[model samples]
Target: MTNEELQTLVKTISIDVFKKPFLHQAKHNPRLRTTGGRYMLADHTIEINPLVFKVHGMDELVGVIKHELCHYHLHLEGKGYRHRDEDFRKLLNETSSPRFCKPLAAQNKKSTSFYIYECESCKLKYKRKRRVNVQKYRCGKCAGAISIQINK
Candidate 1:
């Protein structure tokens, strides 16, 4: 959805779920990588990852908006707004909003190649994402020297 639509949805959800108006901006932020949405304490703006709607659909989008609104409303009211706050948790339960968004499908896929290391004495094998210094590290099984093979 466009930023205009997002702003309207956030405003509507704010009033409907929290009985408060969202007086700040709500926009799609393509730069948000690890979070579904973030409520900016500095500007009181709510930024949602566009991928949430595109990948997870409208229900997920609404849930994310509700989560961000929880932070927005609580902070504005001078109540605890952090995720660990009692006020935030209570508000989330009252609104029935999700505590966390589901993982993206793309993020769930692992395409990583691993470096395989083998012990010289025990033949124990290890897998690591990055190259390991075989000379410095020894096998836990037999304290033997290790060798690295090209990533698979």
Candidate 2:
């Protein structure tokens, strides 16, 4: 969505959910790598990760908006707005906003060990992140026995 649309959405959500009008800007930020959205303490602006709508769909986008709104409203009122604060937690629960955003699908990478297996009879290769029992796992190419060729 364009920045203008985002601004409208944030404003609407603020009034609809919190009974407060959001006066600051809300914009899509492509540079946000690890968060779905963030509330700017300096400007009261909200920057949403563009990937939130593209990857998580509208429901998730709204959740992120609500979450940021919680921060925005609470901070403006001089209430505790940090995640660990009681007032922040209370507002989040009252608004039914998510405590934390679901991780974006695109960033959920796990570091793993690589295991390469080769079939003894067909020479078929298989790459797996976790080790497999060679005795239990066989090659699909020829129903042949498999052995690990490399581990890294």
Candidate 3:
């Protein structure tokens, strides 16, 4: 959704669920990778990861907004706003907001490069995250000379 839509959604959810107004801005932040949404302590703004709606749909997006609203309302009222705080926990329970969001699908993929080492004699294979020195290291199974295959 566009920034204007996100802002309106946040405002609506804030008033409907929390009985409080969201005066600050709410927008989708492309830079947010791991989190569904975040409440900025300094600016009082709410930033939602765009992938929430694109990947998980509207229900998940509303859950994320509810979670962030808990933080926004509690912080503004000068109550405990951290995740571990009693007031925060109570507010979450009262509002029926999710304590954590489901992980994004794109985040669960393996993207790192790795190396495969094989024994020349025994044909045993091993995987290593970093490069192995084939000239010095021998296979553990047969003490045979090693060969390397790069996997990206």
lDDT of 3 by residue, 1-152 (tens): 99999999999999999988999999989998888999999999999999999989999999999999999999999999999999999999999999998887645657676888888899998999888778889989889999985465
RMSD of 1: 2.5
Better of 2 and 3 by TM-score: 3
**What's the lDDT for residue 59 in model 1?**
99
Any runs in candidate 3 off by more than 4 Å, and if so which? Answer: 108-152
lDDT of 1 by residue, 1-152 (tens): 89999999998998888888889999999998878999999999999999999889999999999999999889988999999999999999999999999875556657678899999898888999888888789999999999985679
Model 2, 30-143: lDDT tens digits are 998888999999998899999989988899999999999999999999999999999999999999999877888655567777999999998988999888999997789899
lDDT score for residue 151 of model 3: 64
TM for every model, in the order presented, reads 0.81, 0.71, 0.73
After superposition, candidate 1 runs with Cα above 4 Å error? 108-112, 119-128, 138-145, 149-151
Root-mean-square deviation per candidate: 2.5, 8.4, 3.6
* Candidates ranked, most accurate by lDDT first: 3, 2, 1
- Candidates 1 and 3, the one with greater lDDT: 3
Query: What clash count does candidate 1 reach?
Result: 0
The per-candidate count of clashes, in order, stands at 0, 0, 0
Cα displacement (angstroms), candidate 1, residue 112, comes to 5.8
